[model samples]
Target chain A: MTEILFYSLSIIAIATSLLMIFHKNAMYSVLFLLACFFSIAGLFVMLNAQFLAVVHIIVYAGAIMVLFLYVIMFLNMSTPITIRKSKLVMFAAVLTGLMMAFLLVVSVWQTQAFGQHPEIVDQNIGLAKTLGKVLFNEYLIPFELTSILFISSMVGVVIFNKKEVEDE
Target chain B: MNELINLKDQLRIIPLEHYVFLCIILFSIGVMGVLLRRNMIIVFLSIELMLNSINLLAVTFSVYHNDASGQAFVFFVMVVAAAEVAVGLAMLVLIFRNIKSVDINALNHLKW
Candidate 1:
């Protein structure tokens, strides 16, 4: 059952991600990207990461996607004529992909013997309570710093837009 | 026949390998998107895909270990992802306003 679910969700995730890249319209691409993000969030749920799944939907689908759509609308970008990559860059990208694949294979092979095989994921472990304890206990500093980071980003956005308005 | 039945029963459980495989597929798609697309926003979207793929893996491991800490980290990641998209898209908007396009290939003015 989980295997079937994994494959089906994987197909949706991959297909939407492809559409996101190939779509000519920036609006359409972002929309497809939202679908991709949501499908990934579904995969998270199947992995018993329900908290992350919710956060994925809230953050990526809700917040990030909206920002992208707003930028698209604000720019009022007409359909892109063409977005091209240079041959040299394309070659480099392919080479990098192959190298990364090789490295991944090597690392997995090296670590295979040392690591214990993982069991079935725990299903009853997710909900907010467990997450809260861990966040407030082990990862307290990073949690606090994430807020500071978000505030700085908000400040940056204001500064950038303000500069734009001033120039105009 | 009993052994076969027991084996089938065990197979019904969701294994960690399936999650790992899904993560690999998503990560590859993201890599392809980042490498092939010239639009900066799409590139960022692809980056998000890659991040989400890793998050999926993290969550899978967390569950396998019966620990919630991994999910907690994912929350932080999502927060950063939101901030990243906000700032990234804003920059893209400013760029489009000035240049009248979102193609990264045309960004040669800052190449000095």
Candidate 2:
């Protein structure tokens, strides 16, 4: 049953992700991206990472995609009819993508080592408490730094947005 | 045939590899979108797709090892993603205001 569920959701995710890439219409691509995110979140649930599943839905599906949609809608931009009007840009994009993919494959092939973790947690264990304890205890500084990073990013956005307005 | 089914069953039993492979495919698709798409918003959506793919892998590894730490990392990822979206959308809006288009090609004006 779990296998079936995993395969089904995985298929959904892959399919929508493909659509997200290939769709000519930007809005349709965003919508497909949302579907892909939702399906991945569902997969997270099947993996027994309930906390991750919930957060995935809220963050990607609920917040990020919506923000993309809002910006697209506010901008009222149309999809570019010719994606590759310039041969140079097209070649660059394809070459970069291929190079990155090659690098990723080589790295994965080279570093196939995985840590041997004892399966003590199990599917029944709730992740939130354990995650919180470790995050606040062991990885405290990094966690706080991440928060600061977010705050600075927010400020940067405000400054940029304000600058754009002033220029107008 | 019987042995094949037994092996298939064993392989398909946990579906660990299936999740990982699916995530890889999804991540590549997202990468292709980010690379090939001209629209900035769609590119951003593709980035979110890539992030979600990583999140899927993280959860899968967490479950495979029965560790809660992976899921916890996913939580921080989500927090960062939310903040990222907020900032990204605002920037997109500003960019749109200046250029009236969200095409990546147009972003070259600031390349200097």
TM-score (0 to 1) of chain B for each candidate: 0.84, 0.85
Which lDDT tens digits does candidate 2 get at residues B1-112?
Answer: 3432232243336645555656666777777777787877777787877777787788777666666677767777777877887888887787777787777788786789
TM for every model, in the order presented, reads 0.85, 0.81
Indicate the residue-level lDDT of A140 in model 2.
Answer: 84
Q: Which candidate is the best by DockQ?
A: 1
Candidate 2 ranges with C-alpha deviation above 4 Å: A78-81, A86-121, A124-126, B1-12, B110-112
After best superposition, candidate 2 residue B48: deviation in angstroms? 1.4
Q: How well is each residue in A1-168 modelled by candidate 2, as lDDT tens digits?
A: 555666788788778877777677887877887887788777666555566677777767777777777666676664444565777876787677667656665555555454333434353543577667877887788799888988898899889877866877
For residues A1-168, what per-residue lDDT tens digits would candidate 1 score against the true structure?
A: 555666787788878877877787778888888888888887766654566678778777777888778776777764674545578876776566556656665565555552454445344566677777888899999999998998999999999999999999
Pull out the clashing pairs in model 2.
none
In order, the Cα lDDT scores of the candidates are 0.74, 0.70
Give residue B17's lDDT in candidate 1 (0 to 100).
59
